[model samples]
Target: MVSRILVPAARTAAAARSGLTMRSIVRGFQTSNVVRQEAATVVAPVKKPVGAFRGGLFGFLLGATASGAGMYYYVIDEYRVSNELLTEDIYALQTAVQRIEGYVRTLEEKVHSKKK
Candidate 1:
């Protein structure tokens, strides 16, 4: 019976020494002089959003520049492909015309030989 009583008493003494008692916990939450003074005389600044393009000045210019560059690149690439196709077509037409001319010359020579 004495050992059981001493065990709990020892635990309570150890808790008090380690500052785990109820009185210490209550004192920790009590306001001090510095905290009270700072709270009484504090002012917070009002935050505002930065309005660099809320008036639509810089945003409009940037968008226009990007659009113009995209259009220029697209036109240049389109014309490059079109020029290549046109060159190939012209070469084919020239070869066909030369073959037709040769056939006409052969027919003319045959007619002269027959007349002779």
Candidate 2:
């Protein structure tokens, strides 16, 4: 009850001492447009970034080069691994065929010897 009144009164006194009351704030806002207009007449508009297009192009080229190199490395590595596996498979198949040929020749020699 009394506290509410005292609080408002204290705030008003403080605002008066600080020169920051609502009316003064509103008056400042009313005067601000004139300052803004004067500043607008004195200052230049901001310019666009001169290097923006060049920077973007350089970034795109760098990304493309990196992606191309990565793809080339991946393909070369895959091919090397695939070729190694194929060579191993071919070597195993050749060894198996040689063993089968040896057995067939041995059986043929036995049959020929039995004929005599």
Candidate 3:
């Protein structure tokens, strides 16, 4: 029982010492940079100004791109709706054709019976 208690306490003491030593070692390496100002005057960069033609062309292109994207999505949605309607019409036609085939079979049977 004594050994079990002492073993855990000894491990905890060693862990505490190691953690303190590691923090001190990190603190010893910390440094602050010293900045020296030599030049009193700062130079400004030269920038070209945008002309009226350049600004107008940029605005026109931006508007055209936005409208083109919107029209593309609208066309896609319209195509999907039209495809759905066409599929419905095709299914209706298929059902009508099947019904006509049934009526033809019945008429053929009646004519056969009369001949017999």
Candidate 4:
């Protein structure tokens, strides 16, 4: 009779310990799952269409400004080249006028000498 009672008490103690261990394991898993869910919620950012639109607009404006700057540089370069050409032409005309005046003076002197 004493053996029967001791065996039942021992089995009950072992079963209770196993149940407690299983409960602890289940609780740990639940806690870990909750922590993971919370971390995911905190780390993930929400996307908005307006933010995307703004970024595209900013990029387009930057491209437009760059193109405008390039056009301005091209126009300025053309103007500089034209001005240089005009200055060279003016200098050539002045040189021709001086040569013509010298030739006229020489012709007039020769004609007077022949007449005298």
How do the residues 30-111 of candidate 3 rate in per-residue lDDT, one tens digit apiece? 3334322333244578789999999999999999999999999999999999999999999999999999999999999999
Backbone clashes in model 3, listed as residue pairs: none
- N/CA/C clash count, model 4: 0
For candidate 3, give the lDDT: 0.77
Residues 1-116, candidate 4: write the lDDT tens digits: 44445445566577677774333332232457888898778865667557778989999999999999999999999999999999999999999999999999999999989999
TM-score-wise, the better of 2 and 3 is 3
* Candidate with the greatest TM-score versus the true structure: 3
Candidate 3 wrongly placed segments (more than 4 Å): 1-45
lDDT of 4 at 75: 97
Candidate 4 Cα misplacement greater than 4 A, ranges: 1-31, 43-60
lDDT of 1 by residue, 11-89 (tens): 6677688878644333234788999999988878878875877748778888999999999999999999999999999
Tell me, by lDDT, which candidate is best.
2
Candidate RMSDs in Å, in order, are: 7.9, 8.0, 16.3, 10.8
What does candidate 2's lDDT look like per residue over 54-104, in tens digits? Answer: 999999999999999999999999999999999999999999999999999
